[model samples]
Target: MPLSSLPAPTSSRRVLITGAASGLGLALARGLAERGDRVLATDVARARPDSVPAGVDYLPLDVRLDADWTSALAHVRDSWGGVDVLVNNAGVATGGRIDVATMDEWHRIVDINLLGVVRGCRTFTPLLKEQGRGHIVNVASLAGLVHAPGMASYNAVKAGVVAVSETLDHELAPHGIAVSVVCPAFFRTNLGASFAGADGDMEAAGKRLLERSRRSADEVAAIVISGIDARRDIILTDWDGRIAWRVKRFARPIYRLAMRRAGARIASTSHTIE
Candidate 1:
């Protein structure tokens, strides 16, 4: 189904968001709630984190657990009757060259960043299918669309999200479920604090990029909400992401050159974390 033909988002929606304790997830929860949506904000922490906006329901959800997913589904069913949206936004961050990143690190990131989203979709998709009208929003990153050097694990998992989201968009269209994959550039968020890669230089570089980001979590969340409302299949939340995607698609040679330059820079400065 063409996006134009899909139903527009109603004023009040029942939105379930994972990783809502802080950063982008928190911002998203607040944004949706402020708009009068019934928001179920969840996080992995045993106790609810401070600063979650008032009037939003809180739940403890570690996206990696099947039990948690099941419980979240049950909670929504009991409270809201059914969910209008599922935001698979719980993820951790890591960055290292493939040679430097350990198999254990790769496994951990993939389990959380990629499989976490998978679990959410797998658990909630049946409910969406039953309702025959809903949405799935997966939070990816600019790295998903533009693979940068020294971020093999992060890029791979985020790209997996983008791919899974795309596949679901087509597969679920007939079921009246729209899918949106958000590809936002680095923004001011706690994502960097979760970084646990093997390369010190890569980690430093990533932190620097994040520190320089002009947009805050709330700003990016607002753009993402707009994209969801518009029912966009791919939501590039910033001009940087938008331009990068276009360059890769329409100006391949330039994109390749830029990537090569970035790789060379990383290669020159790369060093293992002690």
Candidate 2:
């Protein structure tokens, strides 16, 4: 079926966002609301996050569960009529040497990071196709492109997200629905709160990197909005994100050397707890 035409950009768009309790998701929700969008913020938290403002609606959604998606979308249908944008921004980071990480750990990471995105895409795509003019944005990471040592699960899932987004871009463009992958460097977000398989050393390394980067979620949200406005297929945020994209594209040797050094650093961190 040919998709319905999109509503005006400046008008209120019925936007469904996952992981909207904190960090990038929350920031994006607020930003979208500020742009005259009726944003529905969903997260695992039963109570709404403080970062979310008064106007946006908050609903409990565990992206790891498929039933939760159906319920959330049902509410959207009931209240807002239908959705125009879907942001699959919910994810968790797990850091560890692949050998030290157990199967359970791998499953937890993959289920939330990669499969969560898949679930959101599958669940919402029909509604989007009916709408005709909708966009799906998947939040990936720079680690997806430039490998991050010790963050095996995080790196793997994010890379999968990138691949999914790229593939969807080609497939959905004909349907008038767009897909974008957001590749952001270490940003000032609590993205590391759900560390499942990472050791203390790996955790510490991640904290230090996040602190050093100090990029705010609001900053990244602005970039994301701009990317969506331009209908870009790949959205890069922060200086490191842009640099990594360029390096991966034009300077493979330099990117490889950097990855090697990063691996060495992670290896040097004495494993206190696995």
Candidate 3:
């Protein structure tokens, strides 16, 4: 359905977005608030000045911690009466080939990127169910659908998120709850800089990819919020993301070949001494 035809979000729609201090989350918060929805913005770091829209309630939250989710949800319930939408937008990337990546890196990525969404869903679903109708937007990535070199851990977690969100869509649909999983190809954001990594090469590669990507965070945020309003099941933020998913679905052999070529290029570059 077209976004224009979906249910209009009004002052009665209460929204809670994680990672709202910056990037797509912040953009969505501002957009929703401008549309007159009461927004509760939460993030791990301190709230950014001028990042949140007027009337938005900003809360400090660490998605990795269950206590943080509980407190944030309570604050939202107390202030807004009930949450109409929950955007699980908080995530972190870990860079490096699987063999070279440390156990700590793998655990950290899974803890935040995958389990964070799980925790949010587990905590907020009851609140949403009580309200009888709501939306859950889980931000996955294009990498979640397709393999990418040097992003094994991050990809694994995001893929898990996609799977979990899809399952929840089925499970929650019967309860009048909607779930949308966002798969953005790439956007101009601080994700690369903020990604936890010890390897310089992996970090450089991540930076290079982020710089080359065409999408902006605002564009991604618009797509996400529109999808939520439309009650879409899968939200692809850009043409690249849509095309990538298509290739993965209908042209698996070709996609595998492309991945192999990219992997070969990385291997060749790694062999050359600096």
lDDT of 1: 0.89
* Residue 8, model 2: Cα distance from true site in angstroms: 11
For 161-271, candidate 1 gives per-residue lDDT tens digits of 999999999999999999999999998987889988777788888888889888898888888888899899999888878899999999999999999999998878747
For model 2, the local distance difference test gives 0.83
- Residues 157-199, candidate 2: write the lDDT tens digits: 9999999999999988888999999998888888767675637
Q: Would you list the C-alpha lDDT of every candidate in the order shown?
A: 0.89, 0.83, 0.82
lDDT of 3 by residue, 1-274 (tens): 2223334565458889998888888888877777677888898865555667778888988999989988988898787788888999998766776666779888888888899999999999998898888999999998889877867888899999999999999999988999999988877888886766655577787888788877778767777878887889988888877888899899999989988987877776552111
Q: What is the lDDT of residue 35 in candidate 1?
A: 72
Candidate 2: residue 71 Cα off by (Å): 0.8
Comparing candidate 1 with candidate 2, which one achieves the higher TM-score? 1
What TM-score quantifies how close candidate 1 is to the native fold?
Answer: 0.95
Residue pairs with backbone overlap in model 2: 3-132
Q: Which candidate has the highest lDDT of all?
A: 1
Which residue pairs show collisions in model 3? Answer: none
